[model samples]
Target: MEVIAAVAAGAIASACQNAVLSSWLVSICPQRDYAKELGERLSRNAHIYTPGSDNFAAATTRWSAAHAPEAKLVVIPSIENDVAETVKYANELGMPYLAVNGGHGAIKTVGKMKNGIQIWMHQLNGVELSEDETQAKIGGGAKTKAVTDALWAAGKQTVTGLCECTSILGPGLGGGHGVLQGRYGLVSDQFVSMNIVLADGSLRTIDESSDLWWAMKGAGHNFGIVTSVTSKIYDIIHRDWAYESFIFTGDKVEALYENINSHLPNGGSLPVDIMHYSFFFNNPEVDPNNPLIMFFIIQEGNMIVDPTYTKPFHDLNPIAVDGEGGVFTDLATWMGNANTSPPCKKAGLVNYRFPIDVESYNIPAQRQVYDLFASATKETPALNGSFFLFEGYSTQGVKAIPSESTAYPFRGDNLLISPVINYAAGADAEIDAKAVELGENLRRILHEGSGREEMHTYVNYAYGEETKQNMYGYEQWRQDKLLELKNKYDPERKFSFYAPIV
Candidate 1:
């Protein structure tokens, strides 16, 4: 059966060279316990650790269906040398490489490596806090959960990915968001430096002072592989409170958006420590009539500043359900692992990073935008599980840095829109077409409605080809410099796997 499967897959690969590599590539099994084995191997070579099969499975499965079961050797490289060797071999073979720091991003580039290598980096999990405990030197392959747990153990905290399994470096390379973002800015913002492996099989340590530091923050992946990330850690004192509220359909769609936007307005009197998100989604588990807009509220300090922050939502309609919890790793766990997200069809986003300077979010065109998305969901029952996510990063820590200082352009932008359209099985053409159409349609609606198309996307969420530009709308000069660096450092482009900038 295995041989037959291999032969069949090989035939498919031969037919579609871009999407599948050669059938000769070794298969990594879901049934086998490879994570721990790989983890041990990595630990020995690099004086670091490796991840097990379960971890690898979680990451690999996160790939979109179009790119799943990617061909090529699925090597569980545990050490930096293993990674370098993998790249070197691929380069020598005139092949490409995909670096899976944490299999979270839905980008298809890595999975479409027809005849290349998949370097799983999860084994590089090393975490240590600085002597002063104000900084942490983290392994490049470490997940947000691992880092968070380490920081929490040391009585400290840092900006990191909200999803547990997402790698700090993976998301940091392109400006990551988290609950701490509202307080500490982006995870990238907290980064002090990184030990990156250039595509040329050389290692380079970068910091804010490094000529390439600024570009590395938002456009790091375009340059090389990061083995370690040094980020500023914060003093530990309080684990705050957060609330999750759900509002069902009524006249609440527009009102819900308006109210959420109001609380997070650019000029609002809300505290910088206050953060929240509104997710409009369909719940397959719930009755159809129970369609809901899930609202999440987070306050930095343990003390609740104002219940009124949720008043806008409360006024919209009666809460269908409400759940509140104290901060800690619990919040992180509740959000979910990187490999598994909410039950939604993984349609990516038309990300927007802009100040709430626009007068109203419910303008006719804006309303049309909402209606369009809502209509799309209703019309396509498959997308009923999809949702729109809008997050307001706390300005307390991030705003202090000038936007121009880093590759991220929206330092001062108070609002970020990440719309996700998730659906289930369809013809390849149909799924791809629908996903692309939805992304483009959302972009058009936002631009035409708000007259503001120039915005940065949350790289973690954006999908497909165009997301690169949308997520990194910093400046042409920055992008140009990154490309030049890519040419110089990764001239071979071995590291251009997942959302590779080049």
Candidate 2:
């Protein structure tokens, strides 16, 4: 019976490739019929886009140009029921499918979606505030800026990542890190409830009370498709934030690490209202020979030059300080105009989340990473735009939450790092290979230097090179529990494309 089933599955796949069989399938199990049925059953708002259509192309465009999955059809579901129907129809056809929101995901698993249907959730974007204004319900496809702008208009704020282009729920699912994380915790922590479409085409509302809620907060991308998320919001307390940018030459790289260690002593605690990000890049305008260190310091209050916070950065004596010792602006304005906006065009990108213990920050490893970056950028000029992001956010609030409360296990203190390389489309294969090699080397150096063999990577920043054990958590018990949940919610592992747990 197993042999017969394998042959049957292979035959179906082969038939799906030829036009004659495709036409036959359409005539027998027509997609238009399904569309009509879906429209009638779940409001006539769902929009279907077939191949060779403009909507299809727009829906397929991902933020990273490297991986573009081809689809036979794309459906823009207007509501949760529409999503459920789409999933049911695709399952009936035995067609592989994926759900796309902001299209910012860069993992290689996205490329595995060949000749499938793309359930584009862009039209479901709706941001509404609750009656008491203490909570906000955001549609699954809503972008970071959309949510931030809506909440800002109502004098409210929440924890969200730095980039405004990615989906709000995309980052939150993998334990999102942001400037506000110092005070409130990860965006996943702020989640109150979520509406998810399960693998069996069943719609379910999950809250903290549900047994699956803990898994959904971190490993949700593997379990189901989220249609909407209700997150906790706070009244605007500190509206304006102080921003400071500092640039240092390569010679000052050692000093930079020393100062960071001094300020972030022990790496587990920090001032709740302050956060900083560091970048190492080869900037010809600054110094062509070596990579420059750029620091972006942000303080939650309105004060421009608070001696307590600003003095440490000033003592470093940077080569240049931009923006009048940091501009005082709201979170939304800062994100929109920030220089860290990711390029919309396609490029090769790699990310790894490295944990920084008190002893992890050393001069030799730091210098070696910087020198490696400079060499790679020189070899491929297109990679000059590439840089490493050091996301060392305060973990005070993150650690405050119980370890077993959610599946996001990296709770103590760590710097989320990503080495991104950008080159024109259809660039030389050697250039791309070198770019990837450089990123992998940096990741190895950081991981090994941390004095730990076991590595834990944040799921959102993972490059698909990590195993399920590494991405989920280093603890064996956690892995066992996640596997049990994966079996319970997705027995057949239908939602296995996006960072599969099985």
Candidate 3:
């Protein structure tokens, strides 16, 4: 059976089997020896680690450490049934459990699981191409790099998240976005079927045949743990990819964004082959007084980005210019999201993102946020590591699908803007509170500029404070339907860690 996502990032390959299953067993339940008892229930390949064990720290380590989940025991499941067994064991003990994959989900809500069990899904990274070669059964614990490399070796490709380190399932469950989305749609759109362990610890393979399928595409975290998924795979179409990167000073903020609005609107007029992304970061060496703008124009099937797309930004007098030509795989490395990039590292920093989706960039809003980010980071030296991101992907393919066809809403919005607040771990209480203030303040500027009362946010990048309507959708039907399904499928709310409906 295949499932969607590589939930647990790659695991300790050589240590899949522990020296002694009972050596590191620690009591999870106060009365009974849960680890010693549960370890006997697992398969030979499965292992259990407690607080003092070396693997326990690795299992608990996350991309963002702020407000992370507190687990009494970590279970590394080697097979699909192992996941079921762990969930069942945790349920029988009446302990909160979270299935952690890539460990990149930074939402504060996950921290609510205290004295819980973490089902670390690192051993499920198996991939099998169908005999027809049109589909691949991906392991539930597979990361973007593993799945993409596996499928690419088979001369096939599928829509996946842009980052190489994140689990395809982590982002895929939240309406996965990627460069290929302009052509194939979001990663969730490619789901053919999935083997999910439901809240009751029953393993079930579901697809369009299930009434719960609609919500699974977008709000999957609230349903159950997916152990494996069969996803739609396509023959590699365009291996050739190219990008042009530019670094601009804060002085060019208005002109830079204005150029994007004219060059790359969210409508069908924007070519599907083109996508844009930019970041506002503090690189004091480049501009000591303010943040630097690093903008990128990535194109498919091109050795050089079309001069038509390059000329408008080139005219802005950037501080520096760079370009690269590579295959689809190199895109991750060039964008600094490869498996070895800093984003993949667990550097003990608390990260927060306040994300808002808008149809276009609001020029004055951009300028105002820039100033706010510069001043706040300058005042608090700890937050200098923070960055604000603006993603503008072409929406031709995304918009081609009917808005109501899937659970993912905000199909019309083009820009996914988020203010990422990063501060050193163990920072005092004041810094933590200030980081929240900056993130929310930055998002509010863009939301107010969008000129709409209803604010929409991408669930994947949300800061855990957004309303159900904000992350899901504003329409009455969308909200009503999601809540209705949440009640039916997960009335106990076992899977309500990342993004809960209620």
Using lDDT as the measure, the top candidate is 3
For residues 1-502, write the lDDT of model 1, one tens digit per residue: 9999999878755544332334544253123233343344443553221234554344455534445435334665565667665555556446666677756566555555665556667778899887887888898789877898888887788887677756888888877767777567788888888887777666677776777788787777777778788889987657766655565563466676666666666443447666766655666565354345666666666544366676666666655857666766766544443435542223332221121212235445546656666777676666665656666656666777777787775665566675665555444566546656775687566656666656455566556465445666647776787677777766766666556676
lDDT of 3: 0.88
- C-alpha RMSD by candidate, in order: 7.9, 4.8, 8.8
User: What overall lDDT goes with each candidate model?
Assistant: 0.63, 0.75, 0.88
Q: Against the correct fold, how does model 2 do in TM-score?
A: 0.89
Q: Cα miss at 220, model 2 (Å)?
A: 0.5
Evaluation by lDDT, superior candidate among 1 and 2: 2
lDDT for 172 in candidate 3 is 83
- Encode model 2's per-residue lDDT on 24-142: one tens digit a residue: 56554323444454456554678878778787787787766766677877888888888888778777667777999878777767778877778888887889999999999999998
List candidate 3 segments past 4 Å from native: 1-31
Report how far residue 237 has shifted in candidate 3, in Å: 1.3
Please give me the total number of clashing residue pairs in predicted model 1.
14
Off by over 4 Å in 2: 1-42, 324-360
Give the Å error, residue 25, model 2: 8.9
User: Best to worst by TM-score, what's the order?
Assistant: 3, 2, 1
Which prediction has more favorable lDDT, 1 or 3? 3
